[model samples]
Target chain A: MMKIVLGSLEKLDFRATVENIRVVESVEQLSKKNNEEITYFLTETEENINAVVRNQEHVYIPATSLLASHQSIGLHIYFDLESYPFYQKVKEMISKEDKPKGVFRFRRTVQHNRNHSLLTGDLYTLSSLLGKPQDIRVKQTDLSVTPSHTIILMNFGGGTMAHIEYTVSDRERIELEWSGIKKIIEFDSDQMVSIQSTRKPTQPLAYSVDAILASARKVDQELIDRLNDFSRLINGGVYS
Target chain B: MKIGIMSFAHMHAYSYANGLTRLPDVELVGIFDDDIDRGKEAAETYHTTHYSDQAGFLALDMDAVIICSENNRHKEMVMHAAKAKKHILCEKPIATNLADAQEMIQACKDHHVILQIAYPVRFSSPIQQLKEMIDNDELGEIIAFRTTNRGQNPGGWFIDEDQSGGGAVLDHTVHMVDIMRWYLNEEIAEVEAIVDSYFHEIDIDDAGLLTFEFANGVVASHDASWSRFTEYPSWGDATIEVIGTKQTVKVDAFQEHLRMFTNEKKSLEYVFWGNDMDFGLIQDFVNCVKEGREPSITGYDGLKSLEVSLAGYESSKLNKTVHL
Candidate 1:
């Protein structure tokens, strides 16, 4: 399970039998890492599209590297028709014998002028298959006098990574940036009031046919049939 | 058919009048209010005949009379509409009390007239979308919900307990509760609330924090307050966030535009200014009247929400939970 980073490939993880490793400058030196056996890597390349179409088995795309590649090479994300091989890997990591769990102190505070008030406070569950250090703490803090502020403290088994801080004076024009960490994928909250980074250990998944079918199992068959019909209508963009 | 507005005291009365004019089938017949000056002024501006007396106004033979009178006067106005055999469009919290609301509903029912409560959010497109999403389980089984129904403290009749029923909890709580019941299509089994009068220095509670437990183990909390100040330039704001096992779905019932920003700090940009949902509601009322169908937010629906508000108030008073 690799955490996708937006900019650099500092903390990308690729767990596979690293068949062979060689620091090569050219295509000829890239031969050892090339074989029928596929290996996942935390690096992006310019030849990804052609490499995949040619079925170059040894070449691998890192999850963290995809965002940049997508932007640079116009690598658009579509429905994963053929479930990527990474799903099995993630599932295995999730069910592994030695898993680490930690708790995060989630606190949301709103500050206006000299007044600071706590909006929400809770403890959250955090489990990781990634290697854990002796002590890992993830948290957010700021001193700027803003109308509101949200702080999340992730007590991870590994080192802490805090990425984003946002403030709204007028709530119309927003300014966003990343510090302490760069590469991350953020999802919009349901209210569109906030954008939150997906918690570690979970990958971003939008609704699709598989989810629809899975949930529809105990539901009414007539409703299932209607939903199935709807899926087709939406995907095909044809009413009938 | 020619339509006539009876009062301009409540803000909703203007919305209803505007909605009526938007329909091709109805025309503005006349306008009247107990306050002669305000009634005459609105009539002149909206271009409708100004009636001096309540009796004279009803004599216009209008198809309906939308009772947007003061909250306390709802019963009298509704009874008058029922007696006139006109279809009734009553502003919600239907009459400040269950007995009055029930009587109004019965009066309309007995007279064979449509009693449509003006819970305009029921007619919103986003709310309809939220309904579809929940029905499809786009959000898995809903575990909890947090709702905010806030507006500027328009004190007058609204703050006066005798006039506006009880205050913010009474005037504002019904809309969100009705929305909750409508969205879940289920009855709330129990309610616990902490209601207070924090915003305005009033004797009655102007804010309510209520937690509702549905029969299906779904828990929800509502924030109904008259805390929006005039400096904000917003009359009211309503939003609901529903959390489920797998996902969350929210409806910004009051606004439309969504914008995002991040610089020295990140923030969201939300503005709900452009569209008019009131027209949709009134249009539905007209369509229902013509087609002989029940209004989307019916009298029964209004009663159910009022019941929840009443229960919440009772819960707060008793300092204990109430079983609905």
Candidate 2:
């Protein structure tokens, strides 16, 4: 049996999904578990990650360990724009790109007054994707009577440009327009991703949560399959 | 109701003038712009008379005047309208600064004129539904908001700091800030922001990320950037994510649009299909004038939102959080 230990359950809504796995309350108990046991650490503290890594005899997974197993996992690392320092860092990093070429626009519309740090996570991902160019420039312009109805233009090297327009005064939809692509991707907060493309002019994909979940599951399963293969190679087929 | 447009500097004057013509029992009396040629052109386009002199424009027997002047000139036009005792629907930000905004509000109040700020996003149907949900506590206690109000930069006087006051920070922060204040019914206590002139070869800053702390402990962040490209499918978007203790909701005001790709344009374009928010806003102002009721979006609302934007600029300059 595959016995998995969870470090912390606070604020985690995925508890029900992990019901089949063995969950221990304390790190001591986790440490005592057999080498075959897999431990998952979800806390933000560096101490917990250190504790797990220190126990080299056992197989442990930090929150970020799974990130390397997949490409899109980086998108899940929420960027907290609420923190002043982090916001500045992000701004600086995005500005550092010299002659960056590409259009990256992120427009997020929300329903109430809430913390948005988590929503900006994709900014880093987008910046990373665009790479460093010869020059990058950013400009903000206000275009509407509504407060906060502003657009941010990012000019990368060459003719590539990215625009992010945000308005709390409007409805809620996360829309992204990329250069060289014939379609725009609209991500609903409910985890539904729809493609509005010129190729399928008449068949705009309706927002569907199941479709997104299914795609995410496929990626997750691929990661799991790779882990299973690694386990088998390390500890013989018995672990598999 | 006989109404006059104060200036043609801002492009919305055309839409407002056209909307007035479509409204029942409302007359677009005349067009008044500082530039005689521009004013005359707008008047001809709207089939109205042009008034070159400020005194002559105010002297007209008008029920109200819509101030669509440049950012710096809003105070002068609004004060003039107030003196005329005409119910006013002034454009956003109220004024370029807190002092100017307060003066405009006080003048309107002293003159017994209804001062409504043009915030059409409040009139969006999806936004109204979101407000209803918040009011009903469907999301439980509100926690924070992440919003973006972005659009393509309208180059011209907009890029000139003297004419427009500030760039994206000043122009963009007010709309979503107004919505946030209305939804949470709380004042913003703190602000931290980053404003940069990273795009375009302009003198003014065009991109900004503003964070806020509400008096009620709710925190929010906004991306008020004029960052849209010419090839963008639509003008831009107004999007917000409402995070509450119990649940979260997202509102995208411009999502209800149809995508079209034609040979003439060569690129894809989004044709919005939602109800005309501008029409709703103008109708509300007209109804308030006729019913003798205070406008739903008041001058104070404009002042409060403008304060946040001004604070954003202060925060950027100081590289620290500003207390409202």
Candidate 3:
């Protein structure tokens, strides 16, 4: 799992901001005292401007050239930008006053996606409509083949900022261009399997959970049938 | 290579000056903003020369020039650079309109010069890797994708339609559109989008959404906004996600350096914010110029992206789909 440590001094009182940002050291010590291990470390943002994050083993400092005042204190582990979700969610929950002086921090893991597309009926239709080409013939079924390493950058709040990508073969492709004022979703083969249904007012939670559980119970049978079909198609017991 | 900046009117001009000075092989030749005070300030802070006119600055004999001028002024700057035959790095939305952008491209081509639009995201390491994975068929097929560039309102000249061409969509949409074309390696066949003023006091739309359908049956959505309030911890970011037949991957390309702290009675806190895209972009432009190659994102890419942005504006006004 990729971990990111972020700190910011939005409050004019520098002492309080530094004090708040120093929590990473304690967190590191806590990881050592306990069995929780630290894998990768990234030192970015203003905290590292004064050589604050240095000489630490496995710590990677990408760039310090463009550091600016009046921004957030943060660090990112690994180069994958997707791992910053916990910080974003925590940042979103923060109130204006509590942001600086009122110490508040939270952490959450992004549930790695395992499904291709978890589209509602409306979303599916809209997606299909958008896929049509005026000069050429395009089929929805043809678009069904999965690209690897899909990412969906959605704006929970309304804005013209979202990103989606996929890796087909070894080439990373930007499947969608940035358009303003729209919802965004990115999904590919490996990440598609984990997409559980989103909860909604119309659908009761208990009912959806039960339905999902029932589907899970059939996995064994489904696997057996799929294996049998493959064997028959291949004209041999390839499993041996 | 010694590089200098010509203007500080663009949002990215200050960072370009800093980056040029920071790179090992590059020396900062100084910066010049049309506004004399702005030029002097950037020059003093960046420790470079501040020239009052193009002739004086071009005569400084710098290896390259970055035109971080207004959208309307890009062609003139490029023409001057063309006459000088110096390599040029430029900001995105390369021109206020398509004709001007074309002229800039032509001038560079005629002069046998490198004209690279400073679309740093194309040079982003992770994005480069993502492109590789997609081309390799690790994912079976690209089903769909979405992208967005949103942030706090950029007032001043950005609000003027003549100065900026349009509002949020115009200012922000081109980069994403270019990224999309680069990723798919295909043309955008048709598009439908909406532009509107919401939560902004300006005459133009502070928010917009565009939907695109590629010829390959891959669907896309792009969102651009400048209405986000700065009171929020961070303003906004450029993010992309691609959904394929088999899996999903998301790119959070927002640049920030942050830290947190807590004591006996408290919790999380923000220590700093470092949002820098120019460092990578400047390095890329210099590399391309040194190597005698076109940029990963070229001026033509800027023109196409701007076309998509403008198409969205037209679609929203007409409430109809557009073919590109």
Name the best candidate (by TM-score). Answer: 2
Q: What is the C-alpha RMSD of each candidate to the true structure, in Å?
A: 18.3, 12.7, 19.8
TM-score per model over all chains: 0.58, 0.66, 0.60
lDDT of 1 by residue, B1-324 (tens): 656666787988887887887778798888879789988887887788888798889877788777778888989988887888878788887878889888988998899989998888877788878888988888776665657687767777777777888788777788888888877888888776656664556787766666677777666666676666554434567877665555656787767654445342334334555467788878887777778787777788888888888898897677566897
Best by lDDT: 2
Question: Whole-model lDDT, candidate 3?
Answer: 0.55
Using Cα atoms, each model's DockQ against the true complex is 0.02, 0.05, 0.06
What are the lDDT figures for the candidates, one per model? 0.55, 0.65, 0.55
- Of 2 and 3, the candidate ahead on TM-score is 2
The backbone clash count of each candidate, in order, is 13, 63, 114
Q: What is the alpha-carbon lDDT for the whole of candidate 2?
A: 0.65
**Tens digit of per-residue lDDT, candidate 2, span B1-324:** 999999988888877887898897999999888799999999998889999999889999999999999989999999988998888999987888889999998999899999999998998899989999999999887766778887778889889888898997788889999999999999999887767765566788777777777887676767777777677788888988787655678898898999999876537899999977888899999999999998999999999999999898898787666998
Question: Compared with the true structure, what per-residue lDDT tens digits does model 1 show for residues A1-240?
Answer: 111111113222223213332223433334344442332232234553334423322223322222223222222221121122332233344335243221111112112321111111011001222232122111112334233332221223232221112222322221111111111111232223323556643232222222212221122344334333323322222322
| Residue B271 local lDDT, model 1 | 53
Candidate 2 off by > 4 Å = A1-60, A63-240, B264-266
Off by over 4 Å in 3: A1-240, B255-276
Candidate 2 docking class: incorrect
Q: Which ten residues in a row have the lowest lDDT in candidate 3 chain B?
A: B264-273
